[model samples]
Target: MKHLTYFIIFFSSINLFGQVNYSGFIDKYPIELSADINTSGNSYGVYVYTAYDDPIVLEGNLQKGKLIFFEKNSKGNKSASMTFEKFNLDSESIEGIWKDLKNGKELKITLSKKNEIGDGIIQKTSIGDRYFRIVADDQNVSEIKIFQKKTDKLIQKLKVDCQFRGVHCISTGDYNFDGITDFSIFESSYAGPNTSSLYFLYNPKTKKYFESGFSGTSLEFDAKRKRIIETNQCCAGSSVTTAEYKVIKNKMILEKERCFKWSEKKQELIERKVSECR
Candidate 1:
């Protein structure tokens, strides 16, 4: 278990693992999990992937993983265990349909039932902005599937147009500062009509596709000189409105419409209004 993938999202208050940064783009991968009580069954419940063409759409059961205890050893002829799951995407892809965990210090029982993989950085964005994602609904609800963590076969599959099986995906950062990376979106419809939106669509320099604002749940961008950052969340609240739209030289400048701010550097949960346009 060298660390790769395990995403289980249950934020009743969140605190079993660590790291939870959700604003625009968020990619934190030290994906890890380990367990061993070998007897022979050769324990296994894994998720380690890196065959990227599309499939990276994980966000349910916070992505699913379950590695309970294993028993049958000492000669009982069954306790030979092996449960080492991993998923880490170079820090973080899926553009077709799109959709979106881990633990233990160590408990090795290596028996060649080997498992461990790689990949990283799937978040960091800018430019017209919009990228936030999460997904879940099955995989035993936590058997493990954190976006390409070894193919149960599901890439960008969030039907109902992301109405929320639990936590759907799309949120990474670069904010038009131009380093390249922006696919912002964070939606949670809670079953009723919770509501969420934010999709700027990739535009890595004339790369194409663009659309911003409406009920854009969360968005942020930076494309070298081009810039955009956004946050608009309303699950079913009242007439909540905080505006800011920037595109300048190309059109879309509201400069600042609604009013609200608490960006002590950008630690905002709500209340937003920062605009610019050309």
Candidate 2:
């Protein structure tokens, strides 16, 4: 009857329904976390966690995915069930629509190929839907996608350069001092010395999305009409970072903050939040 978050630890354990056995025991017994997992193949895996505290560890070949969990007694009786849908996809995919569903969350994930983790954008839409995006490796990349809902099809896809590998977990709701909700992404390719590359792009003006900053991965924020602030490498050992945006006059400022302690309050997230950030 207690609430304790459990991280996912994958071992060569027994495979129940096919997929990697990313399961572990939480401090509390009978704790289950609900997650939605997707991959390059149609066949995906859903990890039913017994806890919701700590971290969700994913090793080896990983893909864009989430987790859902449930609990039952020794008599095969069901208790509570929850789903943690965290991935970066087009705004019109099923995962996008589900993000707008009831009890949705505002979380981000790092997309990866094997061991290389790519950054993604995740924001709270006006109508509760999640606005997630990810830039390609370079300019040849096309179309930045936003997930309108978890189960709905991709609704909005903006064609943009692939130069930046960010946009994974950001908000398009005017985080900067710009008037419109411009798309912001962070690309961190520099990992050599004490410096990192960071860049911010805005589209308030016609055919002008080039912002000023270094190029590297970052936690982005959109304040609708303020400034564009990018936080590179939110913290050490931080799985995902949330970017905070605000608008003052004509400046955009971004910040990285921990998630709100809204255990059950978040369940009441209204659809108005993600109404028109497409």
Candidate 3:
């Protein structure tokens, strides 16, 4: 598919996740915050200053009545931090301290609630042996939660690097052929049945899910053969490509590929070429 990339839309004001929207000042710099506090006391959100063009991702936890958030840069590194001594959702305004990790600079933060959306619950479904619920607005998925199927115990939570627009589909398979099921989310759609997804594989050693950087177009897992099939079609279905991959050390190793071109004479697709990947 098209190169995997995050599509960030600019908005002067955001109602992200339809959960918590705030307008605030960070030491005289105007800022807007859109966030959600999950039931497990974990928080994930984004904030942007009026003078900036991009938003900074914030991830943290609420513990002992304090909200501690770390500002994540584009590379997913914590560059700064914010700790609110007293944060109450019902409160109109709250205060906090912002600290830059690199320069050791500190600033006062004060935010006033601008709006509140009802409990953010975009979709809930179960796959394999886990229950998942996505917390997001109609535009984006901010957090994904995994719960034990039998006990309903929250096992893991993650923030994905993709957007959810319309119908969101989650797929699962034995990607590594390790018995445990791995899952993925549709990332985006492209021309003529071309799409990409973000894969999260189950790690039995850590008992957690890890995001896999596997890239392919419309990947389909063949559990019986333990292979991954990537299908791509373009040019009004006239050009097509299919690739087969084998999992080697938890990585996809391409083995075979085939190309097809539509033939007007035969009124069907004809095999154009075939090759093997080394």
Q: Which candidate number maximizes lDDT? A: 3
lDDT of 2 by residue, 1-278 (tens): 22224232222211222222222232223221122232432222222222322222221122346444333334554343333355333221222111212244333222212222132222211223423434343233344555444343454555554333221223334434444445553222332111232234454445344454423234334344343343322123222223355544434344434221213554321222111211
Per-residue lDDT over 126-218 for candidate 3, one digit per residue giving the tens place of the 0 to 100 score: 455555555555566767777654454678888875565321345566778788888887676677567788888888889899988789988
Q: TM-scores of all models?
A: 0.25, 0.27, 0.53
Tens digits of per-residue lDDT for model 1 on 1-278?
A: 12112122323211123222111111222222212112332222221122322222221122233223332333544332322233221222110111110222333222221122222112222123222123223211111111333332332322223322222234445443445554444444332223354444445466543644434333344455454444342332322344456664334465554533333354343343334111
Q: Of the pair 1 and 3, which is ahead by TM-score?
A: 3
Candidate 1: misplaced stretches above 4 Å? 1-49, 56-182, 185-241, 244-246, 250-252, 259-278
Q: Which prediction has more favorable lDDT, 2 or 3?
A: 3
lDDT of each candidate versus the true structure = 0.31, 0.32, 0.69
Question: Clashing pairs in model 3?
Answer: none
Candidate 2: residue 164 lDDT (0-100): 35
lDDT of 2 at 38: 29
Candidate 2 overall lDDT versus native: 0.32
